[model samples]
Target: MSTNFDEQQWRAELEGHRDHKDDFFATERQSPIPADQRDAFDGLSYFDPDPAYRVEASIDPIDSDDTITMETTVETEQEYERVARLAFELADEERTLVAYSGVTQGGDSLFVPFRDKTTGQQTYGAGRYMEFEVDGEVTAADTVVLDFNLAYHPFCAYNDAFACPLPPEENWLDVPIEAGEKLPDA
Candidate 1:
């Protein structure tokens, strides 16, 4: 696919997504409630969040094809050293914390996977997240996008037999991420 994404194309894709969402719920009979809240399924729904965002654009190294990692410089005198130490440890373990700018909100920011207050209790046990950076064109490490509304579940959510990225601690958000795919029925 071409790297150039025009505004028109993006708009079309968004419209198509809305159409797909309608079709998906029309045929998929499973409601959006846990067994405990069988009656409340009518109230719960996926796509409850709006997609509007404050865009930020920037670039970071691609850690891995499946998992992209972005490195951020911790700026405070005390925090800088602390984060640097953490980065070293992560490198030692071959675990990278890359700032992914492809997903954006509130400005181009890094999107990291994380477990949150909802993990294992209200939402997916693995948890979900969205992130953002300052808004601008992506070049090197200038900025990136982080849209939390897009925090989603892996294919395993649809079926039980797959391993997926259980969101890590750093990726967790204090707020409810009311976007993307919701947990499949248990």
Candidate 2:
């Protein structure tokens, strides 16, 4: 699939959205949680969903010329030996190779927090993310898509009220991912 990321268009959209910080607050004030559901709101201390872009996939197909989804797997705790052996294989100076794994959410969704190489300067200091589907019951046992291009901002980064998940240490990537959303002021 071709990535149609128009830098100028993205920059303009980010800038335009940044200007409406007040509108985000205004809408937040209008949204009320039920008394019984207060805990659900508070319990959502991490990765609160963005009201604007619910869980709906973009109208674009998954593998359209516009966007594409790749598939990979995460090693489960049960596979410690295999993963450990792989890690040892990857303990070299110049380079290393191993079949790594990560959990995914989508069809039984999982939230994998990540900070790409672009953290702090290009993208949000907190981080960005990619979503995927896990096939089984064990949350950690499944396939993942390390699609950097699909990374996106946390709602809080857009407006203060949204609480987003901090990427787990394991999910941090050491490469600069010059894709997805970048700093609005960049």
Candidate 3:
């Protein structure tokens, strides 16, 4: 049985992850903010929590063994196995996004990279990413909860030292997704 996600709990967890020393947002590490400037770093900026951006999507499994090559900011391509397409509604409009898995290794998690109207203005220009793990095969009968509130910027958005895959054109959304991470101060 699937349980509904508690927004408070999820937000708290994100905060914890950011504050933890070994976590991605750790000030001492590869944070987007320069180490000398990190002393003033509080946390990432985010749009207010809105449940409207959270919706359920049906999985449309891909039958072919097609591979998608996504170009990175560093001019290199990363291969991902196109696993499925997630169809859902956002802002009263029907939309779809392709789901992918690592081409080298099979895992329970799926990666979704996307660009929204908010890209380059309020969020990462290259796009943001969301990932979730599923139990067993992802069939049409499986309804996955897609929470835009969980969307995050790629590591490359912070530091150029990191390489991140850019979102494919197929995954770009015309609508503004005002939830999740916002661009860090310049």
User: Which sections of candidate 1 miss by over 4 Å?
Assistant: 1-12, 18-45, 52-111, 129-139, 184-186
Residue by residue across 1-186, what tens digits does model 1's lDDT show?
125635566556645664565454344545222335443334223454443421233344444433333232122111111010012111123222334433222244444555545556556765554444433433334333444455655434434544444443454445444455455442
Error of 3 at 114 (Å): 0.2
Candidate 2 Cα misplacement greater than 4 A, ranges = 1-107, 135-144
Per-residue lDDT of 153 in model 1 = 52
Quote the positional error of residue 179 for candidate 2 in Å.
1.5
Query: lDDT of each prediction vs. the true structure?
Result: 0.41, 0.40, 0.82
Candidate 2 RMSD computed on C-alpha atoms after optimal superposition onto the true structure = 13.6
Give me the runs in candidate 3 sitting further than 4 Å from their true place: 1-24, 27-37
For residues 74-181, could you state the per-residue lDDT of candidate 2 as single tens digits? Answer: 221211110210111111222111221222322343343467566888787887765544444322342222333445666656455555555545556555556556
Sort the candidates on TM-score, descending order: 3, 1, 2
Tens-digit per-residue lDDT, 118-138, candidate 3: 999999889999998767777
The alpha-carbon lDDT assigned to residue 158 of candidate 3 equals 63
**Given candidate 1, what's the lDDT at residue 31?**
25
Local error of candidate 3 at 175, Å?
0.3
Q: What range of 10 consecutive residues in model 2 has the weakest lDDT sum?
A: 80-89
